[model samples]
Target chain A: MIMGNLGFLLYGNLVLIVILYLYLYKIRKIIGFQLGMNISMLVGGFGAIATGVLLIYQFPLKFVIVTMITAVIGMLIGAIFGALFDYQTLLTGYINGLMMGMMAPMVGAAANNSVLFLLFIEVVFLFSLVLVFLSAKNT
Target chain B: MNISQFLFVLFCLNGVIGLLFYVVMYKKRKLFTDRFGMVMAMVGSGILSFNLAMMLFFMFPFNLGTLAIISTMVGGGIGILYGALTRFQSLLAGFSQGSLGAIMGTMFGAVVENPALCGLPAAYFIDVEQHMMLFSLFGTGLVISTFGLLFYSLRV
Candidate 1:
């Protein structure tokens, strides 16, 4: 009975759906960047609200305060991203994600296995360049 | 704290942290105004982290010095997959499913070793549930935010 109240996270689900939409459509196309960003903020901010409550009940005021601060910071970051580049598209986001994903391993390897790591990175980068070349002709 | 409870709470915290991080990273008049280079960065880094996590976890040998290596590996792999797949719509689809997938795998593994996990606090030298729940949540956030921030920073 006690936990059931928080169990009904229907509203949270609803909000997550909305952000998914904006992230996929509105912000992707930059239709109304501010609106989309606001939606994103709602998703994150609401979670913060819920968790802040949980933290206070479960832990202490200090932990709650820290969580609140972190939540605010995350919201601010989303807003900043929206305000700065409201016209970006999801396709582009995807591509950027791809590049970064491919590189980190090399970075990691370099820290441990410099020679082999650099060689692997070079190969991956070379292949990636080719992919970029091919994708460039997509549209 | 309970593992399940910790996971739920941590994810909730991640949601908040992501929002704030996004705001600070991309806050500007021209924010999202142009695709700039972030789109590319996101794709690259996203795939990198996700894949990194998966690869390290699935492929690497189980050892004390290399467990973190797996997490990071899986994270990169996931990132690369994100980059290659559908965006926004695809991301949510993948994220929710992938997260559940991760949880399921972890559950099964633990179940197989239930006796050990539940019993060997001293033998294993770790609080299985509490540790995993906290780490998984934090790791998810860390990987996602890592990609998100890397792309945003690169572009803007």
Candidate 2:
């Protein structure tokens, strides 16, 4: 049962990230540097946290590997998103993502055995994604 | 040197770097506009405090709550120091980011030290010391590179 839920969450997160990427690509030209910085930071930080938590939950034993993977994932996501706008934004996003990624696994591990907390994180992640989309659309 | 000594050296080194950066920024605080100053404060304090907190936690792993508080305070103090050169807005940003980074760093250190605290199996207990050393080294490198970037930004 847990495995099924984890699978669903992981795939869903991937889809959302891809969708976000496409959306950002579509609107990259329209967004300013400030918005770009915020967008990149949001995506990188939350994406890292989600990925770290979900993966850690799936594989409890490979803690070190999971941490490294999540950190890389977060850094990549942030850099990619930030690259759309300005160099400084790229730097900001990269550092923010790195920090969040480094911290995410421990958070996930701390909430061990609590599927509900995972679900809560997922909800919050989705909500933030929606907020980002709305904010981008407004600008 | 052993893990503890290595961590101690790293900790002192991080602090010195932070101080150097602070002094450099202070000397040229007039050159930075509001936005640049805010960014510098936020990034500098956050990263510095994060590395410091992590090393401190690794050094003293017994008192989790106390360490967390100490790291948080240290982070906030660093933030204030950096942000003081700028406006109130920068101060706010630095303080919050610094505290957040410190909290996260302490948590990471705690989890690495005692995987059991996070409900993980203690299979890697023997490797915990190595992990601590590796992470501290990585953090030191991160601080150095970031300060270098900040200094470069000053040049540009």
Candidate 3:
């Protein structure tokens, strides 16, 4: 009927879109002006939802990998690298967000078990966090 | 058990081991065994752990459960907007995210929870069989908090 889980997933994305947009307004003075509206959270939220939906509905399939990788680069590496350089940085969350967006597809190819995939990523997250902390302090 | 059950076990085991690593591994060290350091390490591992759970869902795609993991990750991502907007507020930014993530984590604990919005994925925390969500929540909670602590501990 309502598509149960799909309905809920779509709804959640919508809410995230709103939060991200509101952030755009909140930080428009700071980072948005420089990065443009699209790179900012509001637009990124829409982008992720739109692209994610496409991944779900159209099933172009191939783009799933590209989109997944791009999201990772954008929200994680770019965000963090951007932070280390820029005083105003959203890299940490970006990295984590990318992980959220891509983990499924990345590990989906390998193991059939969700639990194993989660454990693998957690190790990376914690290790990275530690590295970043150590590096930042030493620097 | 099922995939979700496996995930539940994974979270608890990881959390226990992480803490143990803090205690046993750092019993002689100041950083590892220290309250703050231990918290940060635990939280760091927790964030990934939940992400791990989310990844699990992407692989398994267990009906509503998979979507739930998405919600958690997305929610966590969106919350980043908060941290970013506040410019990370204070030393508590990472910790705040962890706390907020836990709150959002509960939504994953609940069904209509929306995988895309809980800040991550439902597969990450879905325990359809044994019905265990505590481990999932704890993992997410530690994640946000760890990020905050890690950020604070940063030299920058």
Candidate 4:
């Protein structure tokens, strides 16, 4: 049952991503990357807030803190991307958010130790930062 | 249900609703009321900030709660300013809807947890109930604002 649910989720996420991509592609001419980034940041930020509240309600304070921090950092990176390449930045944020939002709670559930959780957060944060920076610089 | 299952539902709802709203907004951008967009942005930000603040306060210390509210307000203020300067309805509309969704999600999760809080002491119970009521009221306002921004952009 769990595997089936996961499959369904994976498929749903895939469809959402394709739809988002199509929309972004269609609007490339009408709305530039920067503008899209700005809009996406607002959308992404609120989404992060909702997720944070939900996580905090269910998980331990320490784990939720780490997760929220990671989310905020990711959104910041997305905002920067919006400044550099608006639509792409929003797309990247959207995709990353969908994946991370689905994963963070499970990860938090498994986070029994403080040190491991901190390390996990640090790794995720650094990796996202690097990815966003590289994407921004290269594109 | 467990946290994972709960969050999965929230994630799915967010994705589906966002896609639907974006499609509609994209198709009718030219017809959307520009004047109310800014108002919606401000109201959404305020709702989101208050909801976040209460959540933080309930879960953590005052410091984190203060920081979250301040940052959210600043972010919303900046978005509103940028939207006005650029004459971009998208910025305002996006922020408004995003904040509205965030608050709504938070409210839903709170309601899920509300039954557990019924056995608290009198003072804490009153305090917690007050915050919940405030958050719900704000959520309602945001809902009205979002719908207003969506279909009632034009005056009769």
Retained native contacts per candidate, as fractions? 0.20, 0.43, 0.00, 0.00
Task: Name the top DockQ candidate.
Answer: 2
What's the true lDDT of residue A97 in model 3?
Answer: 49
DockQ of each: 0.09, 0.49, 0.05, 0.02
Sorted on TM-score, highest at the top, how do the candidates line up? Answer: 2, 3, 4, 1
Residue B9 CA error for candidate 4 (Å)?
27
Summarize candidate 2's per-residue lDDT along A20-136 as a digit string, tens digits.
889888988999988988999999999999999998888888888888788778878887888888767776877798898887888888887588888888898999899999999
Q: Flag regions of model 2 displaced more than 4 Å.
A: A1-12
Winner by DockQ between candidate 4 and candidate 3 = 3
Per-residue lDDT tens digits for candidate 1, residues A1-139, read 4334433442443354344444444334433444443333333333333333333333322321333243444344334334433434333332222222222222232233234433443344345334432332331
TM for every model, in the order presented, reads 0.28, 0.87, 0.34, 0.32
Candidate 3 C-alpha lDDT tens digits along A49-76: 3334323332223323343444543354
**Candidate 3 Cα misplacement greater than 4 A, ranges:** A1-47, A60-96, A99-139, B1-5, B17-91, B109-156
- DockQ of candidate 1 is 0.09
Scored by Cα lDDT, where does model 1 land?
0.38
Number of the top-ranking candidate, with lDDT as the measure: 2
User: How many pairs in model 3 have backbone atoms within 3 A of each other, for residues 3 or more apart or on separate chains, i.e. clashes?
Assistant: 45
Model 2 chain B lDDT-worst window of ten: B147-156
- Arrange candidates, best lDDT first: 2, 4, 3, 1
Candidate 3 has an fnat equal to: 0.00
